[model samples]
Target chain A: MLSQLVFGAELAYGTMLYYLVLFLVLVLLIKVFAWKPINKMLNERTQQIVSDIDSAKQKHQEADSLAKQRQDELNKSHDEASTIITNAKQAGQKQQEQIVSDAQSDAQTIKDNAHKSIEQERQDVLANTKNDVANLSIEIASKIIQKELKANDQKALIDSYIEGLGKQNESR
Target chain B: MNDKISTFFLGGLTFNIGNMVAATVAAAIVLVIVVWLSRNLQVRPTSKKQAVLESIIDFSNTTTRGSMSDSDAASFKLYGFVLFVLIFVSNQLGLMLQVDVNGVTYVKSPTADPMFTMTLALFTIALSHYAGVKKLGFGGYFKNTYLEPFVFWFPLALFEEFSNFLTLGLRLFGVIYAGEILLKLVGGLAFSNGIVTIIGLAPIELIWQAFSIFLGAIQAYVFVTLTSVYINGKISAE
Candidate 1:
């Protein structure tokens, strides 16, 4: 009974044709169902990866440029600050020099005015002293002349008396 | 176990129809599964079924590409993959579709039939030559194939052509038919004894069934490999 399963092992032309058709149908179904879709998915994945890398690179370059711009602005502000400080320092120095020169000129003017006033005061004192001394000497000389005049008049009167007595005696 | 595919007389050609019907149904089932599994494929495959299909495609491409250029590999890999999956599945049909009709057991492995495999091999070899002719044109392909190194090689080349289909078909038929026979023998072993037969036959049947699946898959791989080799032979040697 089991040996009947062998069925003589005969090859057939009709079976060959049948299997070929079945095989081709299976091939067609598989091509439609599996091959096209899987390849599409793979291609989409590849494209997504490539575009991601490109965008990332572009963003990195932008960041680098922005950082460079920030650095430039910082440097420009620093230079501007330095220039402002330098200008302020020069203006302070000029103010100090002007103050010093003004003080010196003021002191010189005060000193010259004081010297002129002192010279005028000394001349007034000298004139007052001369007048006082001249007055004092004139007073003393007048006293002396007064006393001498009295004495001389007395002496002259006596001499005149003597002379007149002599002249009268001569005339008589 | 019967190797003869049931047939009917239609018009003039003896239409081989029963196993053809069975095989068509099996192929349709395969088609449905393939379509369903791959319908919503993702770049990053998520489901187990999707992953399994992807792995098969990947392995097929890798192995098939090993022997040929990328372009040829891409084009021919469809046939390779389709043959592998379909034959492998049909070979295992012996496991699933065993049935009794009027006290006779029938298993539905199309590849188990020598004629079926022989026919597939013939088609594959014929297509390979066709591809060769298409690639090199008729005269160039003829000179390249038949008159390669010398005219004296013609007989040997003809022998190679006949032998290619023989080997391709016989190898698969032998393995699958043997597996079916072994399964039958192990089933018979269970009938002869009590403890020893029970334990021994049960384990042997189970292990053989699993191994048979592995064997069937390997045979399918071999079939695809030989087909590609034949195609490469015509494409490259020219």
Candidate 2:
């Protein structure tokens, strides 16, 4: 067998041609049927994966920005709410001060009016008492003088007597 | 030692019928497997078959890319894949079954024959030169292939090309042929004396067969790798 392998081995043109034709045909068929479609599919899958990853990243960034925007709005509204509450509290304080001041002034005015009216009533009562005393004195004097004297003489006497009584009362 | 190959003469030219038949069988097997595996392929692989096919493609792509630029790798990846599949199937075929009828071995590994391997090597070398010439003009291709680094390296480079051609084919032919020879020798022991010899040599035959299968796979991978390397050497400036 070894001698045959060494001595009998020779190149054959027909076999070479046959193999060449077969190989070329095989390559052609594989290129058309297998390699083209398979390579295309692989490339498409790679591109799809890349694009999918890109879109996912874009969505993540969008979600992040949206969350940030919502957070900012929440912070802003929180600030506005606090400011409104402070304003309402301040307004209520002012209203309370205004109401207290108004009530105080009204009480002062009513007290002053009450004092003036009491003083006026006291003056009216004193004047009426003085008029009544004067009338009573005059009536008493007329009753006493009527029983003691004639007409012209009684008038002169009574005046002199009254005058004498006023001088005597003043000296006493 | 008395093995014979079937042959015929047509128009005063000798044709090796056994090698042709074996090569055709190997080619058919490869085609069927490739076609079946590649059918119904999806972007997202659903079946283990698809995964296996994708990995095989990926492996070929990576092997080619390892020796060439991306653009070159892309152009040649399918060639690399086809070469690997064909040679691998051819290498393992003899391990599965070797048929002999009336002192003539009709079926065996096609790669075991020098003619077939040399033919494949010639094809690869021719393709590399074609690619080199296409990428670089003829003058540039000659200059790059024959004269590079220094003018003094020309003789060495020329010798290297001849040796490369010889070695590429001979290496595959040697390993596969040696493995088959050893397998046959061990198998001969099983039928040599009696059942005692058969039972005793069964383990050795099995081991050798297993080793031959491994060697076949390795040779196939080596052939593809070297092919890309040689092609890359031709096409690329560096």
Best prediction by lDDT: 2
lDDT of 2 by residue, B1-238 (tens): 2346668889877798877887888888888898888888899889999898888888878877775779877788888898998898999999997777787676789898887888889988988899999989898898899889888889999899888998999999999998988988888878999999999999999999899999999999999899998998999886
C-alpha TM-score for every candidate: 0.79, 0.87
Q: Which candidate number would show the highest TM-score if scored against the true structure?
A: 2
Per-residue lDDT of candidate 1, residues A115-166 (tens digit): 9889888988788667755765676577567665576577765576557556
Off by over 4 Å in 2: A1-8, A137-172
Residue A114 in candidate 1 has what lDDT? 95
Best by DockQ: 2
Candidate 2: tens digits of C-alpha lDDT, residues A46-165: 999999999999999999999999999999999999999999999999999999999999999898889888888888767765765576467647866667656997788668867865
lDDT of 1 by residue, B88-127 (tens): 7788887778654543444478777677778778878898
